[model samples]
Target: MDLSKYLGLFVSEGGEHAEQMARELLQLEGAAVAPEAIDSIFRHAHSIKGMAASMEFSEITELAHAAESLVGALRPPRAGSVPRATVDALMAAAERIAVLIRERGRGQQGEGKDLTLLLRGRAADPWSEPVAEAIPLKVEPAVSLRDRLRTVRVRGETLDELLDVAGELLLETSRLRELARQAREPLRAALDESVDRMHSRLRTLHQRVVAARLTPLSVLTDQLPRHLRDIAHQLGREVELSVAGAEVEVDRAIVDEIADALLHLLRNCIDHGIEPPAEREAAGKPRAGRLRVEARRERERLILEVADDGRGFDTKKLRAGAVRRGLLSIAAAEELSDQESLMLACLPGLSTSDRVTEISGRGVGMDAVKNAIEGLGGTLAIESTPLEGTRFVLRLPLNVALIQVLLAEVEREVIALPISKVLAAIEIPSGHGRTFEFQGDEAPVYSLGSLLEWKEIAAGSAAGRPVLVVDGGGKPVGLAVDRLVGQHEALLQPLAGPLGQFPGLSAVTLLGSGRPVFVLDVPRLLEA
Candidate 1:
């Protein structure tokens, strides 16, 4: 068998196993080292070494061999169990070996760092000694982190396929429900019960498909620490990057797009916001700068924020640059908020730097970040304080492949509201007082039927508009629609030609009945 074809799988599996071993070792460190932990580490390293040897990759084999030896030394029956220092050193060695293997798999040369030094350095904990009553191993079977780590690494195409299947199931369920509704007799009505069960099962399947597409942001943050190290070295600066809420899960597709966007944002902070150590010290700031990235789920959207403890935007200097470039009127520039003014840096062809530098300020790529993010149906907001720092927050929908939509009818056409954005559905009396009490204040409810000029509502053929109470930037408003149809899991179908340019619509989907339904763009509608 051609081993090279399996190289990706080998690397991915090896990396996953190494990570699991490291986590288990970390948990066992300082505490009584469990035999299982040592065995686990040894097995992982040994397997990697064997795999590399079989593939005839000498560098990988060597690194794995070193790690395996260190781990094997810790395995029991040698008059003592592993010591904390030994375990730690072994984990570090394993990490280095894992990186080398990964780089070798990518056809890059291994770092060839010596692992013998690491092992010898940790040979003596000096405190580890046999005790009269040895620490008891828990009797209950322990769960291995390796066992917990799933074997299958799902691909993007598989997620898309599952989404498509879920949508198809939804369509079938809807069709069956429609048939049951149109049934005429008691015998037919009895058959409808089976259809209802099928519908419920389809919903469950749809939920699973959506869940499978989600991945925690931590997966993407894995490389940021190394990246920070490289950038800090390049600039002769010291940076400590902290990450929070890495466990916050988002749709994998959104995570990928956000990763690319956030990379640019982080580079901007390192390249421009943070001054070198000497410069920072001269300016009375701390020698080491701090950059923090965090992710959290807010309502139906995922929020990603990257903040740096560095020099804030200089509005006066920005205004001067704008004037020099003739991009903004002096009067307009004076009125901009610091946050708003700082956002000008994101504008196409606008850079505060007078000269293009290698680090940043080429003036060509800033707008790409904004455009790429906005293209993903996300909003980017910038926050800055004079001496505090600057933060760029991005809000993205959880998933778009298969969406739970609040199905509603406009004219005779059904529409979908990404269940994420829909705050609530309520019935409002037609033409009642335009203002209603909300949050102790009067708020005006707009009619989607009227805005889109849905013929059924305009012609007064349908009942009172169905008002959907929506939270738009903490301000709640009601959107009136023709009538509420049941919710559906639909595959998002983008609009075609000029109709796609409609300010209030994001995507469209066809119901099982083959009827076209427009998915409401909540953000765009709120903007309008």
Candidate 2:
């Protein structure tokens, strides 16, 4: 029988099992290895092995069998902590199995060399077991049926299409309400009530659809511990990795975009932040350095922090490095405060490392991390205390597609300012404001019309034009607009083609009236 039909199932189920095993192997490295953890890992390996054998994937099956044997020996829990070497071997085997599964899914045959060497190397281990007799596998219908009922995985593209349809329906619903308001008295009242109910239902449906796109942060963070373990081993450092707020959910798309940036940050912590065991002990700290990755939601933003209690960044060294790298003049570097000096670390090709290594020291790390975070329409902040720790904070929008914005009329054009950036909207009295003082620092205020170079048609008095105090970087600036149209939920769409590279504008949104307005890129606009 052709096993091609089961390809999707194998890829999905096999991936989940592999992830589970990887997590359990990391846990097995702890001082106390739980029997349940071992059992869970064994079951996952056994399941994958059986599935691969059924599909005639010999490489994957052999690797899974080897992993299963190694884990099986740890099942009885009669020894000290699981050996680091055993965990490394199992992790490598699992990775190879994952690769083979992906290759088989692509209709490519595995070379089968890696598994041969891996198994041969493990053959002499005391825990190694003889290949067992094949047992006919039996599937329980009830368990299978219940699992099927529990969850269904849908492609992200399908959800995006559904959201698009829902958004269009919402727009049409808004149009109907507007039309109903203009109808004759009796009919107008009836239509208004009906439209209200319809609008409410549509809003509810839109919210649920948006919620469906959210995946817990744990889905991305679960593999991090294993990664940290590998990095620590490679660097000969003893680092303890802990993660919090794993249950916090954000858009799946955002998670995928930020994964690589987070990986780089974690690696930087291992290579540059965390000190070796002996150094950490000499510093009066624990032998195992502490690294914590935490995520949480604050109103419209998701705050992700990666903190390490190791050797924090040295601002003086950073300033010297910046000057040496020609990114800054010596006089300019000398004038920078501690905070400004620390920011120099994000400069490209500015490393303080005396020697180059595989992980870092080429000085291409932090700048890329900052760029990646900013590319997601987010901000990155760094805080460090020498010998205490270094914390990198990333503030990202909770959802990129839908945003709450303050709709304002700039001259004849309507523009959207993300409400998260708007601190307050106030009216400046005539002769009372050409600049707004915020926290004892005054910043020049510009009208939205002036900023866009659109002349006022009627030259109205500037007695009480609305001034929106907005967070521009860390400083607040006031933007004067003709009128505040009010708050709205806008579906953000990126500009395409020629307009894609526009500096001050990040995205466009369609209003309920089907009018498209540009969403200001606050940080970029401030820089410009």
Candidate 3:
């Protein structure tokens, strides 16, 4: 029987088990052992052991057995805190397991196996050798672990292919709908209804495909605590990190990109935003600073925030730094709002740190983070208060594959505006076209067609034209279009090659009429 088919499954489950075990062991450090946590950790170790045993991976089995023994010893019929030394040993073991699982998954076979002594934080080979040795154990082989298939995991490439097929179907459906609308008068009604039904079903399929690709942010964030623990010890900073709403799901692509962005934010906060324990205590703040990474859902978007409660950003210092670096003139720097000034931290190479350090003194990470979020069709906002704290807020689309867009006409061209970003669609009478009268503020209005350099069809028309009320920076603006074409769902396709080089365009999608239209990055469009 071939075992290659089972390799992906073993790696996936084994990796998860290793991470979970590490997380639980982290909680046991310098704290009273919770019976449930210990039991959970023990079960995870036992599962890995059994799985490895069934696969006849002697090295993994031995390592897992040693880890299991340590956890089993800690599991209570007795009551006492797990020793810090024991916790470190187990943490190392868990990390070793994760490394081994990843290596095996990548098709890396061991040079050889050497025993790892984990329980005592002693190892014959430091477990650095692939599938190195570990303490031996005698336990019945539970190979049934091989037979239980809990979930069918699909490769990311397979999903991407499915999405491509779906996108093509979307275009075809749109083409069919247009053909239906243009059909002979006698047959139009039935054709229209049939096409609409197909559209509905296609939408449901698109949704399922998108949902299947949703990944909980927790998978990337769960390791943050352990990382923070390690970094705190290195930095001499006492910190309490709170991670919330990591269960919030987002497209897998976003999650993957955000992993680095989140890490950068965390590292920045710890190295710069967070003050030393002594400094914090001297400032009438708690010795341990508070850091939080939180995620929330708002309609079709996800809001992620990373914050630190330490010595906050000093806008004056930021301004001075920007001016010193020639990124901004002295007058320009002074003219900036405090909020804008604080954002200077994102300016490349503009560090306010008194001395340069490998951790963060070079101001590069924030700008990279900003660019990354924006590339994902997201926005990053910076907030800071002197002596208070600094928070970075990122608002990102839930799924980039399927987008709900408000279609509008500009002469013969159809363009898409992300519906989530457009506050409302209204029509202003011919005479009032220059100003947008909302619930009741007058905002500057620009003809969308004119902005696109198209012949303005809405110009001088007796009848009113459609205006998409949009958030222009922080103020309201009216974008007048030739006409409102109703809302439509679009499959966002990446603009490959040179088409991707254009500014003010986020993505392009094909309309039912077989028209290719660009989805405007509203803010960028307005700015451009």
Candidate 4:
């Protein structure tokens, strides 16, 4: 078997183990280091060392080997309390290892260096010198163990090819379904059932393949806490960053883009959002500031929220900054709501910081963050209060590859509407202007046929005409369709060339009959 294809799995595993070690070291900083913690850290270091050595990543293996020795020295039997100085050294070593792991993760071989001096305690220091011994592994792989091949790496392009092949298979399945529907006779029925089962199995496999391309949200946010710790110390504050739902998954492409923006947001939180320890105490808050990052699946979107318990936004300062920068007229700034003015930070070419600081001040500001998130088909919004804190929330679509689509006919053309975007389908109520009032809100209820430029040929020919009520920011509009054809699991295939520029269309799907059904872009239509 070609193990080159499996390089991604190895990288992902190594990154995960490195992150686990970082988290443990941070958590055990002041607490009595338990034997379990020591063993946990030791095992991670040992495993990483073995893996890196096998891969001939000398620098990574050396760092891991050093970490293992230190952790091993602390294991078990109240032999002696771990010296504060020793714990500090281990923490620094863990941080360096994390940086190396991240660099390797980004496809860079880390710079080589001997960290033995840093790992060793001074001769007179309380900590004992690391005991030297032969490498720990007793058995090695039977295959060629010494040769490390760097060329055996799979780029993301390989996965994209697999996805395209799956899309073609979906088109074939659609053709088979159409053929089955047109057949008549007992033999035809049996054939249709057999083909349908095959289609179902193929669909399942497609989903699994696409899902493997997803990376967890926690993976992107993993570095935040450690950064926050260092920033808190530098700024003379005490803070604890708690992250949950690190397991919520998103496409790797989206995760990579979001990680950079996440770093900036956390930096802003530490530098601007959180108050100093004394001020926090005066406000009847905990001496240590608290920052929390959470991820959760909400419908078809993955929501990531970063919140901090610190002095929140200074709305007055924000408004003043906007007016000074000439982004908003003085009069307009005066009339703006606190929330509205607070959003000015996200305006292009705007910065609230008066002077450049090492942490935050640069020409690039929240505007960059907003663009990056939106570029990923995600939205970024902020909520803050002066005395309370601030929260930046990002909502991103799960993946573009697959969606549960409800097929409906608009005039003579078939359109696939994402099931998540559809509120409900109902009969259009009788009204002039082709409009309807839903929940005391008036919205123009247009026929899907008219919307798609398909003039209705025959109205009322089909009983119980379906009108799909779709949401455009809480205001639901009815889309009258000739029929609710049925539902199917669809692999969203991108339209080719300029046809992709069509409005209100996100992608196209092939039905069981080999016919292309356009998938409605619900969000874009709502904007219209």
Runs of candidate 2 with Cα error greater than 4 angstroms are 1-150, 168-199, 411-413, 423-426, 429-431, 434-446, 449-462, 469-478, 485-488, 494-505, 510-516, 521-528
Q: Give one digit per residue, the lDDT tens place, for model 4 in 51-161.
A: 777666778888788778877766452544466556556665666666676776677876535444555432124255335532222233534545444225456777677
Model 3 Cα lDDT, one tens digit per residue, 43-154: 9989999987877777788888888877776544245556555566677678778888787888775421332554534422222223433334333354456544555789
**TM-score of predicted model 3?**
0.64
Please report the TM-score between candidate 4 and the true structure.
0.55
User: lDDT value for candidate 2?
Assistant: 0.77
TM-score of 1: 0.63
Worst 10 residues of 1 by lDDT: 454-463
For model 1, what is the error of residue 449's alpha carbon versus the real structure, in angstroms, after optimal superposition?
A: 4.8
List, residue by residue over 1-528, the lDDT tens digit for candidate 2: 988888877876787678657755755653455455677778988999999999888888878887787777665765556665566677766766777778888889776566546644664462433255221223246457678788789999998887888887877876787688789999999998787767666766776677789899998899998988988998899988889989888888889888988988888888888988999899899999899999976545789999999888988889988877788899999899887777788888876666576876577788988877766778788899999989999999776555679989977788999886787787766665567565577755667777645333232344488888887776778788889998877777767756756777878887777788899987777776
Over 338-448, each residue of candidate 1 has an lDDT whose tens digit, in order, gives 766777877777776556766555555567788667667777888877766788888877776566788887667677888756667766555454645564766667767
Residue 230 error for model 4, in Å? Answer: 3.0
Put the candidates in TM-score order, highest first. Answer: 3, 1, 2, 4
Model 4: C-alpha RMSD to truth? 18.3
Q: Tell me the TM-score of model 2.
A: 0.60
Give candidate 4's error at residue 184 in angstroms: 11
- Model number with the top TM-score: 3
Extract clashing residue pairs from model 1.
none
Superposing all C-alpha atoms, what RMSD in Å does each candidate have to the true structure?
17.8, 19.9, 18.5, 18.3
Instruction: List candidate 3 stretches off by more than 4 Å.
Output: 1-151, 179-191, 411-413, 422-424, 434-444, 449-463, 470-477, 485-487, 493-504, 512-515, 523-528
List ranges where model 4 is wrong by over 4 Å: 1-161, 175-198, 234-237, 278-284, 319-336, 363-365, 406-416, 429-466, 472-476, 480-528
lDDT of each: 0.71, 0.77, 0.76, 0.71
Provide the lDDT at 183 for model 1: 80
